[model samples]
Target: MAHVRRDKKKLLTRIRRIAGQVAALERAMETEADCSDVLIQIAATKGAMHALMMEVLAGHLSEHVVAGKTERGRAEEARTIMELLAKYAR
Candidate 1:
């Protein structure tokens, strides 16, 4: 998590932006904005969430999972990673 500390400011900035977007989404719903407009915002929120998850997951796998496993054992981990990636793929 030391690396996270190093990137804390940048991460916080992104999270704050996401929070703002979520608030905007709430506003849009309360105001009964156009259906397409709300859907577009929802899509953007989903993309932002996915990007955040990808960053955290990549860091965790590199720092913890791969670091603890042997080269041979990494193949199984790689396969699992690939499957998860495929599941998330657009």
Candidate 2:
């Protein structure tokens, strides 16, 4: 989790932005915004979430998988990442 610690500020900033997007989306829904407007908000929120996931995934790959000293450990990490990716893709 050292890499997470190093990038904590950046990650937190992204999380905060995502939260704002979610709030906006909620407000749009509450106000009965136009369908197109609501869709745009939804897309924006989804993109923000994907971006955050990607950033964390990249960090995990670099810090945990690629940096692993043993082949078995790296393989296990890779399998875990693949599982996560499969779930996320769904």
Q: Give lDDT: candidate 2, residue 86.
A: 96
lDDT tens digits by residue: candidate 2, 3-82: 78999999999999999999999999999999999999999999999999998999999988999889999999999999
Q: What C-alpha lDDT does candidate 2 achieve relative to the native structure?
A: 0.94
Per-prediction TM-score to the true structure, in the order listed = 0.71, 0.97
Compute the lDDT for candidate 1: 0.80
State the RMSD for candidate 1: 3.3
lDDT of 2 at 20: 98
The lowest-lDDT stretch of 10 consecutive residues in candidate 2 is 1-10
**Candidate 1, TM-score vs. the true structure?**
0.71
1-90 per-residue lDDT for model 1 (tens digits): 554776778788888889998999999999999999999999999888888778766775776467845776677767777787888786
Model 2 RMSD, rounded to 1 decimal: 0.6
**CA lDDT of 71 in candidate 2?**
93
